[model samples]
Target: MASNYLLALYHKTLRLPFGRQIFSRMFASKAPYFKTIKPLITELRPGYCELKFKKRKAVANHIGTVHAIALCNGLEMAMGAVAEASIPKHLRWIPKGMQVEYTAKADSDIRITAEIPAEAWNIGDIAVAVNGYKADGTQVITGFITIYVSAKPKR
Candidate 1:
């Protein structure tokens, strides 16, 4: 398979000083809503992605815990990164739906990781599992984002 341009760009940008910040800014320009969470992609590869973000007042809920929606946003971000790297360039993909469970409270910086099976490239819908954890290693949220992947229509 050919190398993914976005993944290549991420790898290249990650090596520069303050590259994470630059990458975040570029990503936010494409998806404005993702900027709200201030996510940093710590790892990205085919079938896997990991991201981290601080727990700030903006993302806090009524009781001062990370809001559920913020966690969901993080989950989606991770899933999108993995999908972009894993999917073949000849194919196209989009989020079909998401199912999530809030297992614990998030009161600290959060890390979200997502993964898909290596054989998931078969034409159809694929479910990528995403999990969020706090700094202390508690699993705070679990989710599966369904992505629809199909061969790009030929002109």
Candidate 2:
């Protein structure tokens, strides 16, 4: 499954339009964030993805800490990258569900990491778990993302 998806990504890169190719390369340089927040993808691969998000005053709720939704944003960013890198181009995946556990206050930068199952993963429903922590190495949030993967129908 890992090899298959990597091959597909390589193939898809070749098929992308000239404009998209350039755009993708640029986007790959910087990870997109939620609204005003910009998360950076520090690491990404077929079976793993990691992103860093800094806490900002705007993202802070009345409690003066990172908003709960902002933590979820980091989780989604990590999981989305894992799905994008792990699933073949012929298939698509969506977040079916998520369970978050916030353990600490995120006052600084938060790093989120998601790992895909190793070995050959069969086509079907899958769940990816993402973990986020503050700069001090305290756990901040966790999420489980359910993804459905299936072959796209013929045109």
Question: Which window of ten consecutive residues has the lowest lDDT sum in model 1?
Answer: 23-32
Q: Compared with the true structure, what per-residue lDDT tens digits does model 1 show for residues 1-155?
A: 22788788887888899887787668656777888999998888888988999999999999999999999999998898788878887889989999999999999999999999878887789999999999999999998999998999998
What tens digits encode model 2's per-residue C-alpha lDDT throughout 55-146? 88877889888888888877876787677777765777767888888888888888889988854245677879889898988888876877
List candidate 2 segments past 4 Å from native. Answer: 1-35
On TM-score, the candidate that comes out on top is 1
| TM-score between model 2 and native | 0.75
lDDT value for candidate 2? 0.71
Kindly report which residue pairs in candidate 2 clash with one another: none
Question: CA lDDT of each candidate?
Answer: 0.89, 0.71
- Given candidate 1, what's the lDDT at residue 96? 98
- TM-score for each candidate, following the candidate numbering: 0.95, 0.75
Runs of candidate 1 exceeding 4 Å displacement: none
For model 1, state the Cα shift of residue 101 in Å: 0.4
